[model samples]
Target: MVKYPNGTFAAFRKSVGEPTFKKNQKSNYYRKNINFSDRGMTLEQMINESNKFYRLKEIAVVHKKPTPIQIVKVDYPKRSRAVIKEAYFRQESTTDYNGVYNGYYLDFEAKETKNKTSFPLKNFHEHQIVHLTECLKQKGICFTIIGFTSLNRYFVTPANVIAKAWWTQNKSSVTLTEIEEWSVEIKSGFQPTLPYLEAVDYFIADRKSKNGKYKI
Candidate 1:
């Protein structure tokens, strides 16, 4: 199923057809429709596309961290192919993505929320929080990219803010107002889709004023 910008879902099907051109046509009649709407892309999908653009432009090197799965059983349906029948997590995974950007070790988790007023803390795992804390202790640039899907808003929240809330506030969720006050709101864009790296640069500059850091 694919979701459009208008909040409607539908099963996607491809149509089979061949291009028919008029005889003696000087130009191609088929026009390529450019969609900047980023239709059917989830928050993660947008980020992934942005990361690809970054990589292509040599702006940053970031990638989604794959969870380590241990296969317990496998089915050999044929000699040339085998499928995993059972598997388990090797251990609790850490963040969603991590990489280096302009000499700073970047580590972050990405999350999407449908709630308009607040973002539930349960969307994050304790292990993930611990991992971010560890990265922070190493002087790494750590943060979270949160998307309020229902509201079409996104924020780049520093890891320190999240750690503080999780350890001290003991709250069930973080209010949207609180997030706005503590995080940098980012706007979606073309080419890269999600322009999160700009917010990252902002974070770097802010950190430099406080602890002396930088960005690309």
Candidate 2:
């Protein structure tokens, strides 16, 4: 129970009725992602919500690419009912998502890791690096959304960074310190959820600045 300035115990909230379990404890949000403040939704769900927010505001259009499916056998028990008994997911040739933001072509892969110290390079595939490198060659914005689930931390890491790491024979994973130094941290929120566009803006602007072509 909480006490007011007068030192009286706080009354129960009538709107919520009586307590069912233990009292609620304040969350330490400074160390955790804001959109994950509730610790309920997955990274994909957060990104999807952020995309919806951007679309509603006419900011930029982005979406996850659906994996191609091959239906081998189908059973129709009724005239109006069809059940897919056999199917296989077709092989993918690209990353998880691709679309346009402002004038830049955005392409990325969303990944999650349970490990706390580092993200394993084994989680990334050679084909993904090749595809992203190709996209970069076309002057497109290519990157990744890496989520450390156990730590509840997230980073916007560039594809080239991952590519470079993969090429190093002895390197097996990327450390948290390396990520903090090289990647842009995403600020999660209630409205946009992931709020990743801000990171994209920063990424593009930083690249342009380094290339001596940064403009307003």
Tens-place lDDT digits, model 1, residues 1-216: 111122211221121122121111111111134322347678888899989999999999999999777777889999999988878777778899999899999999999899999988888877677778778778888889888987777888778676666655458888898777767677676767777787777767767774432211
Residue 97 in model 1: shift from native, Å? 0.8
- CA lDDT, every model vs. true structure: 0.72, 0.71
How far off is residue 20 in model 2, in Å? 55
Q: Candidate 2's residue-wise lDDT over 183-204, tens digit each?
A: 7676567777887787788667
lDDT for 18 (candidate 2): 18
What TM-score fits each model?
A: 0.76, 0.75
**Model 1 lowest lDDT segment of ten:** 21-30
The worst-scoring run of ten residues by lDDT in candidate 2 lies at 12-21
Candidate 1 residue pairs that clash? 208-213
Best by lDDT: 1
